[model samples]
Target chain A: MNTILRYIFLNLFVRLIVNIILGVNVRNRDRLPEVGPAIIIANHNSHLDAMVLITILKQKAMKIVRPVAAMDYFLKNPLLSWFSQKIIRIIPLRRDVKFVKEDMFSDCYDSLKKNEILIFFPEGSRGEPEKISVFKSGISRISEKFPNVPIIPVFMHGLGKALPKGEAILVPFFCDVFVGNSFQWTGDRGSFMDMLGTRMAALEQEGSYL
Target chain B: MPFNIIVCLMGLFVMLSIASTVVFVLKKIKPQKDYKELSHRVKSWWIMIIIFSLAMILSKKVSILFFGFLSFLALKEYLSMIPTRRADHRVLFWAYLSILIQYYWVYSGWYGMFLIFIPLYVFLLLPLRMVLIGQTQGFLNAAGTLHWGLMTTVYSISHVSFFLVMPKIGGLVAGNGGWVLYLVFLTQFNDVAQYITGKTFGKHKIIPKVSPNKTYEGFFGGVIVTCVLAYLIAPILTPLSPIHSIIAGLIISTAGFIGDVVISALKRDLGLKDSGAMLPGHGGILDRIDSLTYTAPLFFHFVRYLYY
Candidate 1:
């Protein structure tokens, strides 16, 4: 029953916010895996990023998509926690440096073990609008354990201008989503991070051509 | 809403259906050459036609609101394409708000306010808002591009909706709907005519830098075809005489070509192809209606001077 309601809520949110208010143009949509144990990584800029990523997935696939979000931001209060975890199904990660490093990715690992798709923003948090910040090595550490899981790099433009961090009002803008080919972990953490950054940069360049 | 207007729209539907059928048969016959783009264009045409017809067929309020929404979309596209300073973000909001007021004037039949809202009022107000932000760097470019975008996308396109509130002139067969039908039909017809003629008999490049595909053969051929059709259909759809209709056709064709090239110039300047991917094969709303931006305002004033 909760699953059905989540689908309905998400579909409504996507239709009203993503599709109607801000038109989205997606390229190479077929590159995304149909079902997963996969990671969909994208640039962080707006709060709308996670919802926009969910909007592009198939209905059945949406059931298994879990976005990795900061626990402090999403699970701040009871109401927000319920809305985030129950409604949106986000996997809240503890961002505090004092937290135990070994157990940090337990939830992400469990979700992947269950054959779910997890979305990651290696930039850690939203930065300046339309700018890509240096990626954190947290994603590399997590992917090292699941070497076979395909990591898809998606570069989104214009959403930051639509609703950037610290802004409540949404200015409608035409957004472009460019999905790059999926790649497995390259075993080395440093090389894997570089590959992900280059892949996203390439997708961003591809969007500029048209 | 008029019976004759409905008949004319039905005729348009028939023509579109025939075109779709022809494309389908050609795709099957020549399976090697890519018909994917052409087929997508035809499919989008059907969707556009349905939406346009429904908006016109609905009451005046819906039609006005619909066109206002279109202006909003065009403005959004324009803003996304151009690079603007961070200082102009609030100014951009006001620019969008101006669309509401402009369309309200159309709904209320206040022609004077509608005429000056964007060109005179919003034109002055935007720079003031930007000035308040106190960022002089790239100020001129931001102000100029933002205002110009509002002019082309919002102010120019709003004239189409004004046709709804236009007083019904005597001897008008299809009322305001026919007036709109006449203007839109001729404008789009001119575009298609030019493309087809240019593809078939085009040899001389009219302007290679701005638009590579435009040719002298296409321009003359489109003008001839549109003028002839305008002469034939003017009396049935509008109150224009044979001579006046021919003149309208000439104005629309030339103006349409100018609009197309102007946008092409913009795309070249921005180092991009097509504006956005709003429409599948057509590129964007701006891409599909680029010609209408020129034709709508010109045709509106032309008819207003002669009739209203």
Candidate 2:
């Protein structure tokens, strides 16, 4: 009953506060995993992108999908910190460092291994909408670590317009979420990043108009 | 007390009877190809109406919060639909804060502060925010977009709450705040009546490019019917004379149509079908409240100027 209440409240709260205020639209969500351990790789444009993606995934998967957010930024403010951790269940990654400790990557690998979905922005950081930034090798590393896990590429267009990087007010606009087919990582580590980048680039091109 | 309870039960029965009859009639009509989708949409409406009724009856604060949350969603959707750059993020934060403050001002019944909350503070803060962010490129366009979101979402919808906060006019039926429910009921009724009338008698597309479903026949027919209904229901709902009620109905209905068209244009520009799929048939929070965005502000100002 508590779970039901939480779900209802979360739905109501998000509907009232986020979805209404931001006018986020989750499209082409049928391609998402209804239930399973998978990697949700989406284009990063704005802070709203993370919320929009996670909200839609929760709605689609009907389960909590932990988003891998940059710990430095999201955990800075107390209010945002609480919301990101409690409400969205964001898994914070220490990104400023040159090399992430082995323990952190192992924890992420464990989550994926345990059938939990992990959301990651392969670009490592947000960027301009006009171009998809060069993807960090972290995602490829994760994929290599868990070859059996499914990597779902999601392209989010217009999030930059919704709440751009430095801007606070959202311009009324429509955003699209295109969830592509899940694929496995079988290639060597050297070519894995190249292949992943190519796939992400393709999704970006396809969903650019959205 | 027994008599009052009996009368309330009788009224409940009558309302249910009327609703069922309408549903029966609608069911008898031939189902369109989109009937499944339409039925799903109607079911969602029933769920929402039930929720609204419960909230209104349960607590005033709950109802206000509910509506405030809705306005928040509508505003969010409006802003999301437009384009912005990285430089405009700070302004966006202020925009969200403005939504919260506007609603808070309304609930507090401080009409004086609510008046200039947006145009004064927000208008100034947005540019200053962008300047602080130090990105001058596309500054004007970004500020304008942020301002538009605040105007439509926060400033406009707060008018409804403002009505609730208005000093009650005398000479009306005692104990039920004057015309707060009246304007809200009539405006929403206008929306319902327009949709029904348009679907039934609509022909000769009106602004096919912007809103393909709207028609001139629907627009006029909805307004006339709503005005007549408003005239009849005024005595029960408000202190307005039949003539004034008729005028109010006409204003709300016509303005509501314009509201739909304006939001429709926004959606078209963004190449979107609905604002969001939060509501199954209703599209999104924005799609459902698009009409309210215009009607609430216009009706609030109209009532304030005329009555208050």
Candidate 3:
């Protein structure tokens, strides 16, 4: 009950303030899967990008959708750890896999088994804002195990300029988050990731996402 | 503050209420695309009017800030739509700074400084800023787009508030807000008149390449109706005599029409259907006030030349 209330408060109020300040323009919101599990992948730029993706989702979808963020960063402090665990519903992943825990992958699989959606920034970390780094293979590597978990590529623009990685103050500027169509994993990681990258970049050149 | 001008404003409110009711009824009856658009516009207008009137009623300072805030939004939309190269990032910062400086010039009523701030100083600073940045790629395009955005949004919009501070020109209420209301009412009413006339009697397209829906029929109908509306309202709302009111009406209608088309040209070049999605039916702040951009400067200087 508390989590539901917190989700509603964050989505309705907290996100509203951020979205307003950022002037977040989320297009193709209906492209989100209404029910069941899917991995939402986007080009990471600023910390705000993950929050933007979560804010853009429908309340119904947001309930089941979990953003896959870095454990070291989000769990660094007790407050962030508590908020990520309780309110925002973040799934932290261990980036340093020298001590790989099988439980991390299984936890994601278990979330999917519960028919919950997972949001992943395939770029792995926040790259230079406004520049889409070549996507890492974390998403594709995880997707191989669940072939049917569709991948939705979302392209975000103007976020780096709005609130860059190190900037403390947010300059209220236009930010467009364009949600592309879903693609089923074809078991070929390289080609699928290439196709995803192309589709995401194309939104910047055209007005179709708007 | 006068009884007659207050009545005139009340009449406008009544007319808007009637229009909103009609659109609401139409939506209930059939909910067609056109009616939906009209209803959305009506709803937005109510919000715009309420906020504008509140600011105006509060004081001249609030009204100036209100218009400044509007220009700020319009500038944001303009800057966002264009591709201001990263090299011009600092130059763009200077350009955005013009919003504050120019609006302050208007609010402070620094007539001499406001006249040359953007056109002269900002123009000089823009190229110099880019040169210092040392990035030569698309230099001309970047500078030109930023200059044009400032010229149209900030310089043109400041003229609206210049009406507020203009020295008394023997009229009903001087420049307290009479002329400001007159200019806005005419230009905006011209827009609605043209759209309605075009939809009803449009046959021959007027420069369909620039704006497809503008028609010869709409063009004439809007001018004639807006002229009459201006003639009736100008005396109560502005200092213009019967003859000058007629002239002001004609100037506003024709100029407003051109302004709307000019923005249409810009958007067409940008390959955008609308400037932005800020307003549901209206498109963007820039779209909403395109006519005002032309009418405000033209009327401000016209009034200033003769009176201020």
Candidate 3: which pairs clash?
none
Worst 10 residues of 1 chain B by lDDT: B84-93
List, residue by residue over A47-94, the lDDT tens digit for candidate 3: 777677777777788778788888899999999898887877888888
Cα-based TM-score, every candidate: 0.97, 0.75, 0.83
Measured against the true two-chain complex, the DockQ scores of the candidates, in the order shown, are 0.64, 0.32, 0.29
Query: How well does candidate 1 reproduce the true complex, by DockQ?
Result: 0.64
lDDT over C-alpha atoms for residue B214 of model 3: 97
Q: Which candidate gets the maximum DockQ versus the true structure?
A: 1
Count of backbone clashes, every candidate in sequence: 0, 34, 0
Arranged by lDDT, best first: 1, 3, 2
Tens digit of per-residue lDDT, candidate 2, span B7-72: 333443465557655655676785433355555666666666666555445555776777777676
Instruction: Tell me the lDDT of candidate 1.
Output: 0.90
The alpha-carbon RMSD values of the candidates against the true structure, listed in the order shown, are: 1.6, 5.9, 4.1
Q: Which regions of candidate 3 fall more than 4 Å away from where they truly are?
A: A1-20, A30-39, A57-66, A70-118, A128-131, A144-152, A161-172, A180-210, B1-6, B24-34, B168-170
Q: Which ten residues in a row have the lowest lDDT in candidate 3 chain B?
A: B167-176
Tens-digit lDDT track of model 1 for B1-308: 68888888899999999999999899889988998888899999999999988988888888888899999999999998988666667777888889899999999999999999989999888899999989999988998899889999999999988998988779788888788889899999999999999999999999999999999999999999999999999988999988899999999999999999999999899987889888888898899889999999999999889988
Cα displacement (angstroms), candidate 1, residue A169, comes to: 1.4
Per-prediction TM-score of chain B?
Answer: 0.98, 0.87, 0.96
